[model samples]
Target chain A: MDTNTPLAQTDPVISDEEFSRFCEFFYRKTGILFDTQKKYFAERRITDRMHKLGCATFRNYFAAVRFEASGEEMQHLVNQMTVNETYFFREDYQLKALVDGILPDLAARRNNGKPIRIWSVPCSSGEEPYSLAIYILENWADADRHDIEILASDIDSAILAAAAAGVYGERSLQRLSPDLIRRYFTKQRDRSYRISNDIRDSIDFSRGNVVDPQFMRQFRAVDVIFCRNMLIYFDDQSRRETIEAMYDCMSPGGYICLGHSESMSRISSLFRPRKYADSIVYQKPFE
Target chain B: MALVRRAAAQIAEDQPSGDLVDGQERWVADLASADASIRRRAAHDLSQMPDAVPMLCAHLANERSLSVRSIILTGLIVNKSPAVVTGLLPFLGSEDANLRNGAIEALQHMPDEVAPHVVSMLADEDSDVRIFAVNVLAALPHPMVPEWLLQVVLHDPHVNVCAAAQDALVEAGEPDVIPALEALADRFPGVAFIQFAVDAAIRRIRGG
Candidate 1:
C-alpha cells in the first residue's frame, strides 16, 4: 500500500450517509458533536487519515477505527477534530455571572467562616484562573469581605507550571481592558505582561487529572468550578465519572460553569441547571 | 479578608479518611455507611475491585442519596460487563424515574456489553421497556443502532414505542430507513404526533 497517495486523486469520497455515520460514531466516542456545517471539516480530516493509512475506502478506515483494540487511530481522530485555543475572558459572560450572581448567592448563604474555594481544572496557561481573580477583585463589591481561595489544576505538568508562572503574551490578553490589565499585570521586558505576584500567589496551582478519582478526592467543599471545554474531549464514561467526581467534591449549592457548548443535563442528573445573568451553570443540589 | 492561599497541608486535611489498605471488605461495609460521603468514597474505591459490580448494583437500589446512587452507577459503568448489564437491566423497569433514567444513561455507555441484551430488551412485552431500549439506542455507539431502531418502527404495535424509535432514527437512521419511516407513518395514520415525528425523522435522515 502506497501511503503517499494524493488525497484528491485516490482517496475514497465520503458520501453524506458515511459522513452522518462517522459523526454519530465520533460524537458517541468523544461527546463532541459535529453538525452538517462541519461535514467538510470532518470529511477532510477523515480522508487525510485514510490517505495516510492507504485505506482505499471509508468503510475500511471506519472498520479499523471501530474494531481496532488499541484505539490509537481513534485518539488521532480526536486530536484532529478538537480545537484547543485559550485566552483571557474568552467566555466572559460566565465571568459576569460569577461576579454578579453566583458569588452573591454563595456569600449570602454561607454561615461557615471557612474560606470560599473556587477551582479551575485544566487551567491552561493561567488565563482562566487569573481571569477569575481579576473579575472578582474588580467587579464584586464583597470581594474584600470574604476569604476566597482559588485553586487551579491541569493534567499537564508543564501547562500547570506555565499557569503558576502567570506570564502571558498579547494574544492571550486581547480581551482585557487596558485599565484592568494595567491594574492586575506588570509589563515585562519581553513586551509580554506577567500577572501580579499577589494574584499569582493567591492561587494554588497543581497538576491533576479530572478522571483520576484519587486526584479528585483532595478537593472538598468547593464553592465554584470553572471546568470549561475539557470534558468534550472525554468519552462518555469518563465524562460521567468526571462530573460525578466533581459532584462529590463540591459543596451543596455549589455551581459549575462548563463550556457554553457543553450541557450538564446531557451528562448527568446529579446537577440542577441554574441560570445566572446571561449564562447557565449547573448547581449541586442541597440535599 | 481577601484572596488567600491555602497551604498544601490544609488541602491534605480534606482527604477522605479510608485508605487503600482498608481491604475490600471494609469498603464493601462502608457502602452501607449512614454517611453519604463515606458511601460515595466506598463506591469510588470499589470500582477498582473486579468482583464489586453486584454489590454496587445492589446498593444502588437502596441508596437514597442521589450522589451515592451516581457513584454506584459510575462504578457499575466503569466495571461494565454482562453481569453489570444484568444488574442494571432491571432498573429500566424501576418505578423510580431517577433510577430508570440513571440505568438507561449507564447502559448507553456500555454498548458492547449491552449489545447482547438489546434484542430481548426491544422485544420485551412491556411497551415501556421497548421505549427504554430505543432510548438506550439513541446514544449507544453501536453500528447496529439504526437496524435495531428500524425493527422497532416496522413491527412495534405501540404508537409511543414507534415514536421513540422514530425519535432515535432522526439521528441514527440512514436514507435507506426513509421508506420504513414512511411506512410507519402509514401504520399510524390517526396519530398526529406519530405522523409529525415520522415526517421529521424522514426530513432529518434525508438531510433536508
Candidate 2:
C-alpha cells in the first residue's frame, strides 16, 4: 500500500509454492523448463512483468496470465523469459554430430539421386544456417559428391533480410578460429565482418513460421533440420503441430537437431532418439 | 555436386500436386486413402476443420500407420473440445498401448476441456484406467491438478494409481497436500516404495 516505495521493494516476493506453480504452468505452456537453479532468474523476470503490468502481487500477475482470454500477457511473459541470442557455433557439438554421424548415414541410405536438403527454422540472423554451410564444406568428406541445399527461414522478415545481408559483429564470430574467419569473411571498416558471398548466396533464406502449415508445406524431403531453441517459445499445441509438420516435410531417416535443452521425447514419440558424437539427435524412422 | 541454392518456387514444384488441393471433402475422402502418406496429409489438413473432429477421432482406431495415427491425434488436439475428450476417453481402456498413450498425451494439451472428466476417470473401476488418468494429470496444467492428485493419494485403493498420483504431485502439489501424502504412507504400510515416494513428494512440496 506504500505508493512511494520503490516498486521493486513493494513487489510481493514469489513464494516457493508460487514459483513451483509458475514453473509447472510455464513449462506446460511453453516447453521451456526452469529448474531450482534458475529460481532467481525466473523470479526477476516474473517480477519485472508484474511491475510493467502494474500488478502489485505475484498472485494477480499469475491469474492474469492464466485466465486472460487474449493470451497477450502470456506472450509478453514468453518474450521476457526467452533468450534469443544467437552466434555462430553456439552449440557446435550438434554440428559435429551432423557432419560426423548424420550425413554419413544419409549418404549411405540414399539410392535416389537428389540434393541433400537441410533446413534451419527460426534461423534468426543466419548464424545457424551459415554455420551449417561452413561445417559441411570444411568437414563433410562427401560434400562435393552430393548437391546440398541449405534452406534458412525465420518468422521475422527483418531477421531474414539481415540473414540475407550476411554481416556480423565480433561478438557473433567469437567461436570461429582466426583462419576460418579470414577464409570466410571480409573485414568491414566498422570492425565487423561480412561472410563470403559464395557462402551467403548458396543459402536460400526466407521468412517462415514453423507453425504455419502453408509455409511448412513448402519444404519437402529435407534431410536434416536444425530447429534449435525455437520451439521453447511455442505453447504445447503449437509445439506439437510444428514437430508434426517437421516430420511430414523431412525425408524418412532424416535427422532433427533441437536445442540441447529441447527433447523430442517430451513432444512426440514419432522420432527415435539416436546418440551421435557427444549430442543426441532425433531421427525419423525409415518408412 | 556442391552447395546449391534452390528457389522456394523450385522447392514448391518438387512436392506432389495432390497436396496442393485443400478441399474439405477431398481431405476427408483422403483420410481413407490406401496410401498412408495421403491419409497422413488428410489428417493434417483436417485439423483446421472443427467438423472434422469426429472423423479424425474415428480414424484413430483403424489407422495402423503410426505416422498417420499421430497426425489424427494431433488433429483431435487441434480441435479439442468436450467432444474430443469424450472421443479420446474410450482409448483409456484400449488394449493398444500406443493408442492409449497417444490419447493421454493429446488429452493433456486440453486442460479446460479435460478437467470436467478427470474425477470420473480417477474413479474408474479399472486400476489401469485410473493410472492412465493420473498419467494425463502428470503433464496437465489445470490448477485443480494438485487437488486431483491429492484425492487419488487419499482415496484411490490401488497402490499403483496412488504412486502415479504421488509422482505427479512432486511438480503440481502444494503444502496442503502434504497431510494426504503423509497419510498415504500409513495407508500402504510395509510398502517401502510408497513411504519413499510420499516423503519425496512432501519434500518437493515443502521446497526442501
Candidate 3:
C-alpha cells in the first residue's frame, strides 16, 4: 500500500492489478518511465479509490480511475506526477542578469529600434514567461511603446492555464515583495491574488512542443530566448539538435539563458559566455 | 495576501508623488515604532525598484497581507539573497496560510538557507502547513527530507487537506507512522476512500 517502498520483488509489494493502473494512468498522461519499483507507493495512492469504489483490491481501483479519468483527470495526474515547483521569479539571478546587465547591452545593438521578441521555451504554468514580462518591464520601462514581445509556451496545458490566469495563491508569493504584491496583484480573496494586468498583458501564452519542428517553426528571431531547465531532461543528441535549432531561431547577436547549474560551455561553440564583471551571460556569436 | 495588495495599490496610485523614495530609507533606518500600515505602505513602495531586498526582508517577520508579503518575497527571489531567509524561517509556524506559502516559496527560491526551516515546518500544529511541508520536503534530495517524510501524515479538520497529506505520506513511505495513520483512519473512519491507505500504511509499518 505504501508506494514509496519498493514493491518487494519476492513478496510482491503491490498487486499487479494496481501497478497496471498506475503505469497506465501516469504513462498515458506524462509519458514518464515508471518501473515496478514505484508500485508500492503508486498502488498505495490509488488503492484508497478502490476502497471507496467498494472494490477491495488494487485491480478494481485501477479499472475505476482508468474508466472515470477524463481529459482533466489526465491533466491532474500529469500535474501531480511532474515536479512543477515554480515560484514568482524562479530563475531570479538569471532574470536580474538579463534585465539589469544583459538587456541594456542588447538594447545598444538594435539600431533599427524594432521590438525584441522573446520566447520562453517550456514555460511551465506561465510563471516563467510572466517573469520575463516583469523582467523586460523593469528594464525597458519604455518598452510599452516598443515592439518588445514575450511568448511563453509549454506542453502541459494545466500549468499553461495557471500561467495564463495569473491567479496565484498566497503561497506563490513568498519571494515577491509587498510593494510588488500591492502594485501588481488584485485580491481575489483572503487567500488568493491575481497578478495585475500590467504583468499579465505583457505575455502571450500558447501551447507548444519544443521537440516538434512544426511547433518550433512558429517561433522566430528574438533578442533573448529563455529555455532554462528544460534542456537537461532530453538526451544529449536531442539537446544538441535542439540547441542548433534554437540558435537558428535566435537573432544574430541574440542571447540565451540556461538553467543555473547548466552551461553551453561544451554544448556548443556557436555561443560564448559574454563575460561581465557583475554576472556571466551568454550571447550568440556574430553569424 | 490579496487584501493587502489591493489596499497598497490604492495607496501607491493615490499617494501624492513626493521624495518618499528616501522616506523608505528613513523608515528603515529606525525600523521601529512604524505602524503596520506605514510599514506596509513603505514596503510596497520600495519593492518597485531593482534590488529592493533589504526593505522586503525588513517586513519578513511582520504581519502583512500575504499578497503584500509575497511581493517582498518576490523581490528577494529576484535578488537571490539567502540572508532574507534566516529571518523568514520562523514564519513556518505562523498560523497564516500566506505565511506558510511564503515560507514554502521562499524556501523554494533560497534552498541553501531555507531548507532547514522547511524541515521544521513538518512538525507544525496545522495539518495544512504540514501537508505543504511534506510536499516541500519530498521535493528535496537531502536525507533529512526522507526522514521528515516518515512523520508527514496528519489528521486534521479538512478532508481534502487530510487526503492531500495522505497522498504526500504515501509517496514518502512513512511506514513507522502507522499508529498515527490508523488513528486518523479510525477518527475519520467510514470515509472508505482513505481506509486502505491507512491499513496499508499500518501493514507496511508492521512489516506485514
Candidate 4:
C-alpha cells in the first residue's frame, strides 16, 4: 500500500488542496468564511458526515455538498460546524438596555401605528429570542398594547427545530433566576424545562441565514435585532457583507445588538454606537 | 527520514544563530503578509529552523492560519525546549481540539520539562485543561502518569474529565488503581459510563 499516493487515500484525512477548494465552495454557497485556522475542525466535521453517508473520500463529499438537490448534507455540515452556545439572558446588561432604553425610544417614534418587530439571527436553541420575548412581556407596560412580533431565525435547521420545540437543558437557563424559571418554564420529567406557551408562541421561529440575500428581505423595517456572538466566526468580507445586509434589513433608527466581543465599527460605519446605562448598542440613524 | 534528520542537524550546526534570528524575523513579518500563501510559507520555513523554536511557541498564541499553527506546533515539538512546554500550557483549554492537541503533542516530546507545568494545569479551573494535561502524561513513558491518572480519576469534579482519566488509566494503571476505581464507583452511582470505565481500568490493572 502506497501511503503517499493520492489514489490510495482512503482515510478521512483531507489534503490542503481539497480543504482550500471546499473553503471556496462553502463560502460561495453560504456566506460563512473559513480560514486556515479552522482546517482540522472543518475536516473532522466534514469527514464525520462523509463516514455517516459512506463516502470514501473528501472529494466525493464535496461533490455531494455542492451538487445534491435536497441540500440535506449541506445543512448537516452547517449544523455540525456552527457553534450554538447560548443561555437565557446570556448578556443580561444588553437585554436590560433594550428593555430600559431602546424600547421606549421605539415606542415614542412610532409612525403609521406599525407594530415593533424584533429579529434574532442565528437564535441558536431559542435562548436569545425567548429571552427577548420574556423581557418584553415581563418588563414593558405597553408590550401588550402594541402588537410586537419576535422573529427568530438560523441557517441550521436542526437548531431551528430545537428552538421551535422550546425545551432546554439546565445549562441553557443558568442566568435565569428561579423566579423567572418558575414563572416561564414547566418542569419536565427528565429534569429539562419546557418554555411556557406564552413565551414560545410570541416568537416566529424560522430557518434563515444572514448571508443569503434572498431570505433577508422578510426582515425589513425591524425595530431591533439581536445577532449576538455569531459574527465573531465570520471572516472580514463575510462580516462586511452580512452587516450591510443587516443594515438593509433594518428600519431607519432601528437598533442592532451584537455579542459583546463583536463590533460593527470595524465591519461597517452604517450603525453608530449608542451608550445605554450599562451596555453599548448600535443604532441605524434616520437619514 | 534519517537523511532528513541528519540534514536538519547539519543545518543546526552550520547555520549561524544570527542568520537564524534574521530569517525567523523575516518569516514572522511574512506571517502577517496580505497573501495567505506567503503566511503559510513563512510558517513552514520557521518550523524548520531550530533557533526559531521559542518564537514559534510564542507565535502559536496569535497565529490565525490553521496550517501555520499546526506546523509551528511541529517545530516546537522537534525543538523540545522547556519553554515550549510552558508556552503551550495555556492553550490546553482552547475550544479548538486542533490547538489543544498541538499543545499536548508538543509537551509529549519533553515529559520532564512538562511535569511541573502539568501539575499546575491539573489544578486549572477548566476541566478540559486538566483532561489535556492527563492526556499528555498518558502519551509519554513518564513515571508520573499512573499516579496523576489515579488522582484525576478519583478527584476530578467533571464526569467527562474523570472518564478521560480512567480511560488513560486503562493502559497505565497499577493494581493500586483497582481500589481507587472502586471508590470512584461508589462516589458516582448514577453515572453508568464512569462505572463501566472504572471496571475496564480495574480489569486492565489486575491483568485480567
**Best by DockQ, which number?**
2
Compose the digit string of candidate 1's lDDT tens values, residues A129-236.
999998899889999999999999888998888998888999999999999889888999999999999999999988878887678868888999999988877766
Model 2 residue A260 CA deviation (Å) reads 1.5
Candidate 3, residues A1-287, lDDT tens digits: the string is 34355434333245454355367445532345467785444455444334345665443333344333122333344333445477778868777777666776767777786666777878887777766666566555445545667777788899888888998887677777888778778888577888887667667777867756556545556678888767656533346557755764567788888765456753444577875434556787663
- Residue B20 of model 3, lDDT score: 38
What is candidate 1's DockQ? 0.40
DockQ of every model listed? 0.40, 0.45, 0.01, 0.01
lDDT of 1 by residue, B122-172 (tens): 889999988888898887767777788889989999999999888777654
Off by over 4 Å in 1: A1-81, B14-21, B182-208
Candidate 2 on B1-208: residue-level lDDT in tens?
Answer: 3899997657889777766877998988898899888889888888778777877888899889898999888888878889889989999999999999999999987889998899899999999999999999887766677788888989999999999988877654446778888899999999999988888777766667
For residues A224-270, write the lDDT of model 4, one tens digit per residue. Answer: 99988777666434565577567656778999998775667655555
Estimated TM-score for each candidate: 0.85, 0.87, 0.42, 0.43
Considering every candidate listed, which one attains the maximal TM-score? 2
lDDT of every model, 2 decimals: 0.84, 0.86, 0.58, 0.72
lDDT of 3 by residue, B2-71 (tens): 0111211222254445523555566464334344334534554565554555556656667444434544
DockQ of candidate 4 is 0.01
List the lowest-lDDT window of 10 residues for candidate 1 chain A: A1-10
Off by over 4 Å in 2: A1-43, A46-81, B182-186, B189-192, B203-208
Interface RMSD of each: 3.9, 3.6, 18.7, 29.2
Calculate candidate 4's fnat. Answer: 0.00
Q: Model 3, DockQ value?
A: 0.01
